[model samples]
Target: MESVKIQNRDMAWHIAANIQFPPNFDAAMTWATIIAVHPFGSCKEQTSGNVYGKALAEQGFVVIAYDASFQGESGGEPRWIEDPTQRVEDISHVIDYAVTLPYVDADRIGVIGICGGGGYVLNATLTEKRIKAVVAITPVNIGRLFREGFSNYDPLGALAAMAAQRTKEARGGELQVNELLPASPGAAKVAGLTERDVFEATDYYKTPRGQQPGGWTRMLFSHAQNTLGWDAFAFAEILMTQPMMVVIGQKVGAFGAYRDGMEIYGRSTASKDRQLVSLEDWSHYDLYDKPEPVDLALEKLAPFFKKHLNEATGQ
Candidate 1:
């Protein structure tokens, strides 16, 4: 694995990425490339790069895991803004960089997106046809999340609040940011949060199990405006034509990744070969870093990517 910097094509930001090569990578021979997109509030070094990137490279593909432009080691101001439009474009910008590499087969590009990244991948594939295959692991549609509410809060009320906050900031008020979860599972329980996804996310992101510098789950309260009206699977039934694999855990929660996965699969009517795999015993966070669940997901992903990537080239 090696760290690389990719310039965003549509923006002024520089994206920080980690490129992982197969054990016996041969630059003389081009290989299928996979772009691994991390979850929201996550950087490349987390599950995307450290887990899936490394594992997929060992499975004989070139994989590059990257931090979103406004987050992680990437260069951007007012950091941690989760702009859905920019996030979707980041995938294409990564493709622009990938195709320039001598070792990459431009026609055989694929992508695997975790959590929010999964939703971004779906949206990106709608227009970026260079992507031949896609994997959405525990996908979450941010727009739907904002619209439906995690804690069952009113979406319109929250939108009004964000509008007010943005106006306040414009008028020289303090910029507001919020922590995504409690300090730890213990603290979450103390706070009277009983949701399984909430506790699991806290365990993974707030503790040593998965916590890191750029994965702090901080969000700009006003910037959430980008997500309120956006839909990751918008027009997917008409535009989502690539082969896809949607993996989800049966344990649905406030995060609603399972619901998003199901909806994406059902809506991507144009995808000739879309598969949805549900791990009956797993939860959303389990697939993030758990060895067993991740292993099961890879078993499906490795072959799916291999076949589609190779077949795309008629090999």
Candidate 2:
């Protein structure tokens, strides 16, 4: 694994990434590359991205796991803001950088998106034809998840609150930060989060199991402002043409229990190949780092990318 910095198109921010090469990798060989996108408010070093990068690298694919601009070690203003459009562009910028490497086969580029990143990957591939295959694990359409409540509850009040907050910010009110997770294990229970929602996530992000200095629980209030009308699957019925695979947890309890993935699968009409894999007895968070589910996801990912990318590039 190697840490490197690449400039975004406007030269406004330096994207930080960890590039992993397969064991005994040879610079003379043109290897397939995979961009592993991290979840919201997370970085390149976060558990899901790191685990996926390493796992794919071991299987002879060059993997690049990167911090989205404005978060982690990457450069940008209004730190911790989550803009879905910018997040989709971030994958393209990383691809621009990846193709410059001598050993990378540009035509064989693929991507794996974890959590909200999955939604962005789907959005990115709409016009980024260089990506030959895509894998979405326990995907969430962040914008929809925020605009419509996870359980499909109305978000009129929430949208009104965000509009008011934005006005306050424009008037020089201090930016408000919203927590992505409960403040404590006890707080999760008090918030009425089931054991499935809190257990794995709390252990990974809030505890020592996978916590990192760059990981944070809060995001700028502007994130909500940006996501109000964004839809990750806006053009899935027409524009999403790449071969796609979606991995979801069968026992997930959050966000209507895998409804997002189902909608994505249903709407993707142009994919040459599309599949939905449900991991039995797994919750949404379980796909992040739990060995059983992560391994199962990778097992499905390796062959999908290998077959599609190889077919595209004749590798």
Candidate 3:
């Protein structure tokens, strides 16, 4: 794997990324490319690069896993903000950088988005025509998630609090942030959290199993300002014309990825071809780093990208 820096053209931010190559990779010959987008509050080094990026590269494709602007090593101010617009644009910026590499087959470029990254990548496909294929694993639409709080909690009240907090920040107060989960499963259980999504996510993000500085699983509270009014699949039926594969775990909980995946798969009426792969045993968090679940997702992803991208490039 090679460390690389991609420039987010619109914001002039330097996005940190890890580019992985197949064993005995040849720079003289162009190869299909894939950009892996990490989950919200997670960095490139987590499942994005360490899992999907490396796995995809070993399958004979060049994969680039990047930290979203403002979250990881990427350059941006007011750090930890999850601006959907900037996140969506980051995909194109990475593509722009990918095409400049000699060994990358720009025409055969594809993308895989994990968790919230899945939603961003799906949204990116609407305008970024260069993307030929997509894979959304346990996808979450932040907009919807924010608008409808977990398990029927009132979003209006939450949004109102955010507005009040922003007003305080505007008055020179410290910026407030939102932590997605407890520090550990033990902590979650003690807090009376019974949802599988809650404990599992805490285990994954807050523990050494997947913990890293960049994937701390926290975001600025005002992020809901952008997310509440946005919808990742807003116009996907019309503009999302690429081949897509939506993978989801059968365990549907408060996290809502299963619902999001099902909704997008149904709404993407314009996709040239789309497939929904559901795993019976795996929960949403299981797909993050678990070997069996990851392998299950890759089983569909590898051939999907290989077929669509190679077909598009006639390679």
Candidate 4:
């Protein structure tokens, strides 16, 4: 239940991480580093990253759950901005801090990313060998999620918005948006009354269980520029080289997305260590903090880390 604030290199931003360590853990005996990424608009603590980090901490790993830049307590201007490149660098910086900690086993580091954070982890894993394992819960391929269902790779709309927002700030500033539609504009809106993309997001952010007021913000116009295919499907070739564990709940309709990854894993001539696990009657958000899937995922995952720690350490 300890937390620390860290400043990243490149003057990117200062990130606040909530860390948890196992009772009487030693740096030399089975130490682990976990980096949990939150969904695009959510902060580190308000989402599943912290929830699962706590669970893994109980199992003996040192979990570091952090807010992505420009969102949450992390520093960045034009709040709620999305930049795939900067966030990936942010991941590297977090890993940098983890390695320097006496209690963290630099060689056995892993990452846990929930929702959109899942996509960032994938991007980092493909490029950053420092990442040994990945546990993506109820994940969203941020890039594909913003592909507007692949309507097109067009970027003009997004660029224009960024310009407009910058101009407005230069002239005068005000809160742009309080919340965005849960589903993309192209996403099939749920059949019902007042709500964003889904009832759960609206309920989650508006209610105490998932709500963290003053920490949420609206999307930057076409913010998709940073996410739309933000190296999503493109990274599969590289991802096949790492050990990846995907946890998908039956609801949230993400098995297909899970399969998307499994198919890639299947093609991987490099990594046969990949695994796909499903929880019955469980939806995407169920794994966030709910009992069933969270317990189920960790039951299987903690052991995976235990066995993989050796490979991570080359022992």
Give the top-scoring candidate (lDDT): 1
lDDT for each residue of candidate 2 in 1-315, tens digit (9 for 90 to 100) = 788998856658899999999997999999999999988767778754578888889988999999888888888887888889889999999999999999999989999998888888988888899999999988888888777663135567666777898889889999888777775666677777646755557656877666777788568874466676788999789998999999999886655338888889889989989999888888887788889988898889888988997886666
Candidate 3 vs. truth: CA RMSD?
Answer: 1.5
List the candidates ranked by TM-score, beginning with the highest: 1, 3, 2, 4
> Candidate 1: global Cα-lDDT?
0.90
Query: Which parts of model 4 have CA positions greater than 4 angstroms off?
Result: 27-30, 149-175, 181-197, 214-217, 222-224, 254-269, 312-315
lDDT per residue (tens digit) for residues 1-315 in model 1: 788888755778799998999999989999999999999888888898889889999999999998897799988878789889989988999999999999999999999999999999988999999999999999999888878864256888888889999999999999898888898889999999768888888999998999888896988888888788899998998999999999999988789999999999999889978999999999999999999999999999999999999996675
> 143 in model 1: Cα distance from truth in Å?
0.6
Residue 161's lDDT within candidate 3 is: 82
TM-score of each: 0.97, 0.93, 0.96, 0.83
* Model 4 clashing residue pairs (backbone): 143-229, 182-197, 183-197, 250-282, 251-283
Q: What TM-score quantifies how close candidate 4 is to the native fold?
A: 0.83
| Per-residue C-alpha lDDT of model 4 across residues 1-315, encoded as one tens digit per residue | 677888756665688788888877765665777887776677777664557877788887788888777777888876677777777778898898888788777888888777667767766777788888876766666666555443334445555665687677667876455355443322424545233225555555655767675347466553335554365446465555778887776554422345444543454446547777877777665666777677898888888776776564664
Q: How many Å off is the CA of 95 in candidate 2?
A: 0.8
What TM-score does candidate 1 get on C-alpha atoms? 0.97
